[model samples]
Target: MTDAPTLHFGVFEVAAPQVGGTFSWAHPRSRSADFLDPQHWIHIARVLEDSGFDFLFFAGGYGYPLVDGDLPEIAATKGINFSAIDPDYLIPVLAQHTDTLGFVVTLSTGLEHPAQLARRLASLDHLTSGRVGWNIVTGASQNAVADVFGQDAIVPHDTRYAMAAEYVELAARLWEHGWDDDARVVDRESGVYARRDGVRPVVFEGEHYRSRGYFGAPPSPQRTPVLFQAGTSPAGRAFAARNSECVFVQATTPARTAAAVADIRALAAERGRDPRGMKLMAGLTVFVGETEEEARRYEAEFDAMQTDEIVASLYAGNTGIDLLALDPDKTLHQVLGQGSVGEMGTSNIDRFLGENAPTVREILDQLKGRGTRGFRLVGDGTQVADGIERLAAETDLDGFLIEPVFEPADLEDFGRLVMPILRERGRLREGAPGNTLRARLTEQPGNDRLGDAHPVLAAD
Candidate 1:
């Protein structure tokens, strides 16, 4: 029999009081209220590093849904994905507190100029000793963030992705070829700091963006941060095949997840790239306990935190579809038939439109449980491990991006209970001694760089 694949583990979080529909910030067991506290983050970093997690994936959202310039009342009042302090600032701070755990921060292509973004990430790469990854998003909340950026209308979805292609190209060139490895030579005898002749400015003049300058920072442990992308659309899958080292999938079922993995790998193979090189990480939330009955009780308590109003508001904020405004008795099919969802709807909406059409009431119930986020497990250590092991065996998933329902506590429970079982089964590897995030994830001991087949290496 073939040996089971070792799974990589990461925590999905945001620099906010609550993540998604998890309105458990006010719950007695939650530390989400301490979001603004430096110690809170410091505590999280230490726990994760000590728990043997691979990285902390910060899913950043710049703004809430604004319909006709009016913010949803419940979004603010209930604290649903509201007040997301910049993760870029938080990542560096957490980097200071921990050593091995990697960080993957979301940065949108529509948000800033490539030079500024590139320089920031390169600096982070150095500061973290190369334990950094970039989760590239192409303005999923365009209309919501448009007013904040002083734009009148949402940019077309494909247009944003197209612009992102150029944006990443410029950023990659700056990281890869902006300066020679020996460009920064500090020679006291010759009174020379850097060899001017050795440094060359990487010039990129694309239709969407143009950059012609030396990279602000030198090559860090990983010249380019490990690229991660989460999109399952035709364009997104293609983009991931071409650029991402790890692809994040939130499919609702094992079969769907397996198909997505096959599709992307096949796309990569067609492009003359190694199909097995890219890793597929699924989003999963686990309510783990020592006993099956105890786990269900915890899941129930966590579910009690979400209210109907908060559910409607959070869903509206994410997909621009107001569940309350629409007739609760109406099926999702009826809702979709009324108009084109266009860019407003996400893959979550697509999942609901699958095999069976669910009513608005049914959908709201799922949202209340944070169903749209990803696959969920509610069981004891043995049962949860069984689910995880079976899913990995069936879907060929390399890992899971664990979403925490309660701040630190949920993750703490997972680390204490489920992880040990996983390790014993040989489903999780012991902590690797690799210094860089790329090296750790890829299991290469010393090399902290992207493979030659990566598109960034070919960027001009």
Candidate 2:
């Protein structure tokens, strides 16, 4: 009989509070003051490393929180803060504090030039010694486009994906072919530097972006950063299959997760790549305690603090559907079927509408107390472990991106309690002192770079 697949774990977080209604400085454990503190991030890095996590994934957007074309509700309710201080700044600091922990930082294709992004990521890979991953996102919020990118409106959904395809393609050329492995030569006797022939200009002109100069940075340990994508639409999945080594999906049930995983793997296979090489991680949030009742009590406390306005604001920000404009009594299927919902185009809400058909009230209730709509696991250590194992088995998921309800404390609880159970069950990684993010996640040493089948390599 085959052994159970070795499970990888990562933390899904932003620099700020991930959940809505919990951003207040009034919270006794609030770390809002330390949003810019290097030491605070250091502490988090150490904690994650100690827990044997594979990576700390940071998700960020470019603008402030918005609701119904304005930020009034988000400002008043203090619902989800989208203004996470740049992860690019935070990763270098955290990399200095920890040895094995991997950092995945989000960057939007619509907001930055591909060549510039390639330079930044290449520099970071060297700084982190091959422990960095890039979470690639096509822009989401119109506010981000207007406020940050200085655009009049957000790009169309399908058009954004097309631009991202070209963006990544150009970036990949820079990363993969700009500099040869033997380019850097430090020869004192000859007084020579890098071999001139080993470096070449990457010239490309696409509909959305173009690059026509030699990439400035030399190759780092991993060469190109491990590519990560989170969209689940058909175009999104195709992009992930072509470029991503890791992919994230949000599904409310094991069956949905399984289907999504299968679809992604099939896409990878169609692209002439190894499906198993693409690590598919489902987003999950867990609340753990010494006892089952204690866990429920903690969840109850969180649920009690949730407000309807906060819920509506959060939903609006996510789906781009103005929940306040819709009747609470109307079911999601009814509203969506009636063509009343606007075209914001987020995969999470799309999946929800397609799969669950929950009412507006039910959707609000689901969002109450929860930061994300991913699967929720709440119980003692054994119960949580069982839930994880069952979910993995049923869904064929490679791992989970654990979303913390409360910073550090929730993670601490999982590390102290749930990790041991997972370890004993052979569902967790044995702590390794020095491992690249790619190595740790793929569980294969010396596999530090993208596989030959990766589209980036085809440019050669």
Candidate 3:
């Protein structure tokens, strides 16, 4: 592997809006309402692929985001596209349109059967020619349990991760050991279609799940899809160390991101794996324009599209904390105490509170003005590139998971304006390289299968 401080890039998008308001779709110059159209995503895939992005990561959840404790306002106003459509259906279409771009689709381990998830992901890997990644998430919203799964209540956070641990282990066995390397012998000469010994049945009985059958499909190019985990709690970190190939993290500053990366790498080492094996990708939102003033203008426009109530509601949905009910004068520490809303959301709020100790009202103002929960980089092409370079250098991050503001236009602008600067600085890959998602992200061409350090292989 190369030791060069080269940077990688990916986009963080939801299948639909997760909030109750709109920005890009409301812009006078934007035609973003066609976001639901397959053509829109196809165009986006091509733009990102041509720009040499490593992947397009999709975020998802089950139920509508609540406003305070009610969902009426969000639903009536069409606030966010709370779980609009499945990325599983979208990835294949995107695959057909783009040759080099990787597709990372989120799947919650808390809701699906392991065997079914394994089969679906394996088929996607085949369809994408090994360019598929699975973002493993343990469901956070209690509404998902009731609305999506017909369950009564949400599973406890730590318990959900515990179940996910077993779920992934079972799925890994199906992916890794279900079929031999040469299981698919299409020889038509002898009357023998295949060897019975090549395919093996996987019988697993875990605390939360049980399965007994051979994997239905043969191994694809990557054998197992690239594993991505997005959680920052202690249990979540432990899970990532054992199973994740790429980790999605959110931090307000490069220093905080560096600390998170350091901790994850150390955890990986403790688990008998190479510290660098797990790639840390910080979540960021970018607003790019031809000039700094123009970019700031765009940022202001987007920021204005959001209101304090909508911002607080989104925050409440993420962390299970009702900011609307909070005392405006109380510090976050005094209000939140030890209870966590969700792994990723709670971590971010805690980081912000620890750093700034902003009161509830101040926090709401920050959220309203920022337009995103993570770091927001707003500038012209050169300025954005400089920020990216500095972030990579200071944090030793593998890359960023960019959350775009204006569906196609924002990304298109980045490609046309910002990418050339990044290329000139030798920060981005020069060409497509035509490889699997795992190989592309890790920069280790031809090594498509899971490494020996993974817990799945240890189970062998």
- Best model number under lDDT: 1
Q: How far is candidate 1 from the true structure (C-alpha RMSD, Å)?
A: 2.1
TM-score of 1: 0.94
Best by TM-score: 1
TM-score of each model, paired residue for residue? 0.94, 0.93, 0.93
- Candidate numbers, best TM-score first, in rank order: 1, 2, 3
lDDT per residue for candidate 2 within 1-460, as digits (tens), equals 1278888888887776454334433355445446567787787778888987889898887655465457745644463655557768888888888888898988988777998899999999999989999999986555535666567666666788889888888888898889888988978999878999999998998998987889989898887788999888777888888889999876667887788899999988988888998899988878899999988977777666677666666666665665666778876655564332333445756765755477777777777766454778999999998899989999988999887776667788899899888888777775465667888888888778875567756752
Tens digit of per-residue lDDT, candidate 3, span 254-312? 78778888888999888888888778887777889999999999888887777776666
**Which lDDT value does model 1 have at 32?**
81
RMSD (Cα, Å) for all candidates, in order, is 2.1, 2.6, 2.7
Where in model 3 is the C-alpha error above 4 Å?
1-4, 17-23, 67-69, 75-78, 81-83, 333-345, 352-356, 369-372, 430-434
Query: Which lDDT tens digits does candidate 1 get at residues 1-460?
Result: 1277779998988888877555778877788878788888888888888888999998886777554347877667767767778878888888888879999999988888998988899998988889999999996555678778898777766777788888888888888887777888889999998888878988888899997777868877788899999988777888888889999976667998899899999998887788887889998989888898989998899887777788777777667777787788877665664432556546667767767778889888877868347888989888998998888878888999988888788888898898888888877655554478987887767868775557756632
Local distance difference test scores for all models: 0.81, 0.77, 0.77
